[model samples]
Target: MFTSRAKIAQRLLRRLHGTNATPLAKRPARPSVTMGRALALGLGGAAGLLGSAMAVASLESDDAVFTNWSATHSCHPAKVYHPESLKELIDIVATHHAQQKKLRVMGSGVSPNGLGFSDDSILTMSAFDRILHVDAAKSQVTVESGVVVGDLLSHLRTHGLTLQNVASIREQSIAGVTQAGCHGTGAAIPPMEEQIVSMEILTPSQGLLTLDDPSDHRFQLAKCGLGGLGVVTKLTLQCVPMHKLLETTTLYTLSELKKVHASLLVENQHLRYMWLPYTDKIVVVTCKPYTDGSPIGSRISDDIEFRLEELRALYKQVATVPDPDHVNWRFTQLRDSLYALDPLNARYIARVNETEVSFWEKSQGSRVALSDDVIGFDCGGQQLVSEVAFPSANGSDLTFMEDLLARIERDQIPAHTPIEQRWTASSRAAMSPASSPLQEQVFSWVGIIYYLHEASPSLDAIKDAFVDYSKLFEDVMAPYGAAEHWAKLEFAPRSALERHVLKDRLRSRFPLEAYRTLRNEWDPHHILSNDFVDELCSTDL
Candidate 1:
């Protein structure tokens, strides 16, 4: 049986995908499917040997490589500075400024869009992780840039305070989260970036810029500056009292959700939908603060054994192909199981989608928990995931989503399980995806995901399919004034014309002119940018 080997494989998968913002060497091209980079994933060796190689790969070196969480982007910087203090951070920037060298500030490496990639100087403030102060009177917590969300929440719980909203992942740094304009689900609540009361930035020409002055033009721009304006050293966030929350997961079809989405938005403090493709169901997850602390609803989460049995039955019939150790066979065993045989076939994919719908039907209810715990949930491991934000002012986003799913089925795109949908109120941050002149407007953030387990039998081909699927969404969302989420925005290999097209796309959606003006004025040397950033805001464009 592949059970024992699969368990060991998962253990090695987690270790091999290390993060100090660590970098792993990309596996060389395979002549065929044999091993399928299993050695690089630590699957070839026994567990002992696997542990040794992981240590070696994880150890920081003189020429240490920096790879993002997705392993799609990496950089070997000339210097990786972990500045311990604000003074130290300023000094590094000042030196780089004097040398006319570029610097890209990296937080916890949570961004998958190459937002922090630089071949020059890479700055990580991992050493500057400290919760400076918790103001009891104001309900605010001051933290250094490197302080991650998980740590901050634990500290906040002790102080009887929590963030106004939560992000999907706790491992993300406060700086990274805000810069990306990360958010939770709520039409009434703005993104995490909107929570920042003030921030201290280290710019090249300006030196140390403390953007507390709301009237200042740079203040709003700096809040969600896409990590390009400068190195975010410190932030003060407005917090709320820590409390228990009641969460409920209710299932609905797309038509049902459309009929009741307005009511759902009105009733719930936190709301998000998990729309399973090739099926008629959408998993509705709603959370609200429960003052009484009484738990409601039985937990209707996944019955793993039941799910496994269904998949096993299907696999026994359809999975004639061998090679049980394929890495993609775990969380998405059904998808990979089918893909291992016939990839992207509409008829075959429908069978897998039916299995997913069955799993959701068997388990979809909720329980009570802390506000933080309920807000942030699991976003599956390693994949090509991208979220596009578009105006939902008049249910336009709803129309867009319906059209997207229709397109997927019509085009017979071998789509994944959940096309997770979330909503956020407007943000003042100039570059925030949800930023708008009208404060009352709401935007929908829809994530299109395709898991890319490296040791999968058909990783390359499936990745190509994902690219096509994602591009289709981008094309469809364009008319809806859609903008890619800053953190998950993607830029693949492109021509000069395509690059210009991308810049034009952003120009239509974001306040690019103001952001670029501030960027140029503050960092005249362009020390705080990478190629991906430069591509978008370049004056030459």
Candidate 2:
């Protein structure tokens, strides 16, 4: 009984070649007026000098900047510089850090958090994109930080190798993805960071230190160091032989889903389900190893997009669609298989509009792509987002999600988008948003996302609501020591940011103060302090 939405989405995904494939449509031309205005708005005269310097150094690779993604964080890097070699990257970091300029790294730019931005310099690992070496005997592959996941997977596929776990989107960089401990659905496997056998950290001073020896204790934690310890120049990853996955999708009510939670998780290799907030209908997907010659053909499907489009159409017709409760029931009753075939069938395929679009309509009942105008639906100029991660350790009682839905409705927040809750097993990374200092058990994570739709709200109002509501939900789960996802739009305040995180419990984890010691050890002249890191982390100006 997998509903049409989930099933069609899966089929559409197969045709899209795993999310990056372009839809069969023409590139809509930019409005001349919009283009002229944007060019006019560009910083000209003396300020334009910096912009020009960036353009000259940008990467020539099409795979260089994956713009299909959204900015999780607030800061927009003025320009993205793609370095082709370690020496060049080192020079870029050195020069920017020397000028006390803010520099942020770009890797597929998939996070919804503002952690990856600087108004001045954006560093791209595109040039560093290569499989430097592979030890078949050890089952490890060393790679530069800039390599794309799909590209990495395709290359590995040729040699019978794959990363341990990948997030829903395979467009993230190996460095950036693991930097925040990105993960997939699986009880036994930890987040992506666990797959790192070793890494080469390029500190402003320490040049490059090959971090290995998983038993070092600190090594495990530092694997997802959020580019804080230093820039990740090279990584030695543990890989498995490429294998096919058996996946099944089904629908259930929230009440019904609770009954089978244990059986679904304990009995399956990978399990994940999504329930539209305030709705009883749940879409459950389970994936496991499949070797039964399951029609070795492309398992593509476009039917999901058709179903999602149907859902969108339904939402449009309802006029008053904000009530999550109503949305849930109405969406469930709608036909699901109107677009898809039997879930067990092979040769699945379909297309979709994977591009992120805004809710705003241009003409009556018509919508336009956000990128068409460049400013992105005006998005009210800019917005901030905060995502908190809670553990499912207590059980998938639906209580956490249920409570969240109620609160948002009670407060009447302008939550225009569907709330997302993805699950990942606990991580062993020291600085990951999903780690607990005092506990050593695997925790099921529930990620809560709230987009600050408009900056018009009073700063105090926004901050208070974000902190208070989060604390309420977080406090209830704090006893379990739930961790947060690193790359989202919201982060814990300063005091709490230090307290709840292992970076404080395990000060030796990042050695921020000791990094000062290492800063002196490596670059005594203070020649390479990145302003983005300095300002964001509150290192002395």
Best by lDDT: 1
Model 2: per-residue Cα lDDT over 107-144, one tens digit each: 54556554454455566554455677767777778887
Per-candidate Cα lDDT values, in order, are: 0.72, 0.49
Candidate 2 stretches with Cα past 4 Å from truth are: 1-68, 71-81, 94-102, 293-385, 396-398, 412-418, 436-440, 449-480, 489-536, 539-541
Q: How would you encode candidate 1's per-residue C-alpha lDDT over 1-541 as one tens digit per residue?
A: 0012222233334555332322233222101111112222211111111111221111122434556666666776665565544666677788888998987887666676767667777776654566888899999988877666777888889889999897877766788889878888898899999899889888888878788876676899899888888888889999999988888877798778889888888788889988888888888888887877465768765556664666656766775664565333454545555545655566776777777676667667777788988898766656678788877866786788789989998888877767889998988787888888888988898998776655457777877888788778878887888888887876675567776787788887788899888888888877888887777777556
Off by over 4 Å in 1: 1-62, 293-295, 301-303, 320-343
Q: Please name the candidate that would achieve the greatest TM-score relative to the true structure.
A: 1
Residue 496 of model 1 has an lDDT of 79
lDDT of 2 at 386: 46
What is the RMSD of candidate 1? Answer: 8.2
Please list all clashing residue pairs in model 1, or write none if there are none: none
Q: Give me candidate 2's TM-score against the actual structure.
A: 0.64
